[model samples]
Target: MTRGFADRIPVHIQQVVEAMVEVFVNQSENIGNEVDYLQVFELSVDTADFFSMQAIAHSREEPPYSTTTEFVTDTAITEKVYIISDDYGLEGEVITYLLASEY
Candidate 1:
C-alpha cells in the first residue's frame, strides 16, 4: 500500500518544520517563565509550480487548543522534488509571539 500525501508531507517537510519548531521552543524558554511544550497539532505546506512554498504550522500546549503557528519557504525545488525549511526571519517570529505571552 502506498502512503498518501498527508503521510509523505511530514517526511518531506520535516526540516523546515523542525526549524520552525526549534525557534518556537527557544522563544518559549526565553520568555522567563514556566511554559509548556505540548505537541504539534497541525502542519501543512502548499507548493506552487514556481517552486515557492507556504507552510502553515499549528501547535498547542494542550490538546485541541492550537497556540502556535509558522510559515516556511521552499529552499530548493526540481520538477518533482521540493525542500522547505524555516523562514525564521518572518514566520518564525509570528509563532513565537503567539506562545510567548500565553504562558
Candidate 2:
C-alpha cells in the first residue's frame, strides 16, 4: 500500500511552511499596537506539488477589520507578507493562498 501525496507531506517542507508562518507573525507584531496580533488558522496544503497552502489569519484591531484573499507565489518571504490592507499596514484579517511551486 502506498499513501498519496496529500496524505503524507515531507517533514522538511512542513517545517518550511511553519517557518514562513512564524515570520509572518513576527513581522506583523513588529509593526506596532495597531496590528493587535496575527493568528494563523485553517492551514491546508496540497502535498501533491508541495507548493500551495491556504491559511486564514485573524487580525483583531480597530474598526474596518476587513478580510481579503491574496496569493503568494515563488517569492522570498519578508515583512511585506503581512501587509494586509492599505489603511493599517499589517493590521486586518486575511486568507492567504501561498504557492511555492517554483521553490
- Indicate which candidate wins on TM-score: 1
Q: Give candidate 2 misplaced runs (Cα > 4 Å).
A: 1-7, 33-103
lDDT of 1 at 95: 26
Model 2 vs. true fold: TM: 0.29
| Backbone steric clashes in candidate 2, count | 0
The per-prediction tally of clashing pairs is: 1, 0
Best by lDDT: 1
State the lDDT of candidate 1 residue by residue for 38-88, as single tens digits. Answer: 444344445566455544544554323334443445532211122122345
lDDT of 2 by residue, 78-103 (tens): 21122222334568545332232211
Quote each prediction's TM-score.
0.40, 0.29
Lowest summed lDDT window (length 10), candidate 2: 76-85
Model 1: what TM-score?
0.40
